[model samples]
Target: MITHRLVRTWEVLPSGGYSTAWAELTGRRLAARGRAVGLLPEPHWVTYTLDTGDDYVTSRLRVSVDTAGGTRTVDLRNDAGRWTVDGAYRPDLDGALDCDLGLCPLTNTMPVLRHDLHRGTGGGGSGPHDFLMAWVSVPDLAVSANRQTYTPLAPDGQGVGGPRASRVRYSSGEFQSDIEFDERGLVLDYPELATALTR
Candidate 1:
């Protein structure tokens, strides 16, 4: 299979930190590695690797964190909707299709690609679909189930000569933001969270 490489960098708006990622795509399956450093709830750095099936659902995730206190790591795997965290079965994460790494924009690409949202269209029909995510808290690696929604939005008529971009309204509880994505389903802007840094 021919492999395609993608590289992206994001600036953490709130923490003045940054994240960079390198991904390889092979026949719809994706494998990625990323690093993040931030000063939010505390000073910390993180490194992660993610693997997903052809359907764009997360299959394996490994995250490592370094803090002033110490270093810790977590490994999560999803096998046909069943999940295991750190080699232990996590019933609470059952049925989750994706993992949301805190402060990482790269994680959002899966769902957007799955739903064809990057093309400014719903997965199949018009919808604000709900998704179950294994939310990983940074600096702690605590895993939990999070219910999030993704709503496809019409383009704002801004991309005339640049790369094709799409918009989506991402909502979790009361927090909501209109995120912009590139043609490849990678995040371009994530409102108050992060923004892609062009090279």
Candidate 2:
């Protein structure tokens, strides 16, 4: 497969902060590096890899956050469906599905686009669409498995086959957020948070 490289600029919503990143995606692998500054309460940089075929089979994600408290770092990996933080395996996360990094919205796009999840038909029977994924938060720099759901939004008249945007709601214990993504599955807008400047 051909390698596709993308560069995106992001704006921290409400605050109008900014960040940028470059990503490369091949057939069954993805590698990306980004610098996030002023986009959050603190600035940070992240590098990650998603080794997947039809699903998120494994991954390695690392981040370094710079804050008033001090500089904090986290390294996490998913091996053979098991999760590890820093270098120690966490039995608690053994069954988690995918990983969510703290610093970039780009990483979130992987599972969304890769899965091509069906657009629910309607009404009470959209079926069980919730997905369990390993989530990492920059605010706390902790990793956990979280449930997330995606619903197709009203048609926006874009993309090849149909509307492109989808609503994403995720909850990890006490943390949650409603996010939006484009047809390509890259984050479109993050509400009071961040918006992608590049398509």
Query: Root-mean-square deviation of each candidate, in angstroms?
Result: 1.8, 4.3
Our model 2 lands, by Cα RMSD against the true structure, at 4.3
Write the residue-wise lDDT of candidate 2 on 1-199 in tens digits: 7987878878866333665767766774667677766535544443344444344344777777676677777888877777789999888777766677655677677655555532322331333346667778865677877677654433344432236555555444565665676555567777656777777
Model number with the top lDDT: 1
Looking at model 1, report the run of 10 residues with the lowest lDDT sum.
Answer: 154-163
What TM-scores do the predictions have? 0.94, 0.74
User: How well does candidate 2 match the true structure in TM-score terms?
Assistant: 0.74
Candidate 1 lDDT score relative to the true structure:
0.87
Clashes of 2: 1
User: What Cα-based lDDT does every candidate model obtain?
Assistant: 0.87, 0.62
Name model 2 segments beyond 4 Å from true. Answer: 14-16, 39-58, 118-128, 154-179
TM-score, model 1 to reference: 0.94
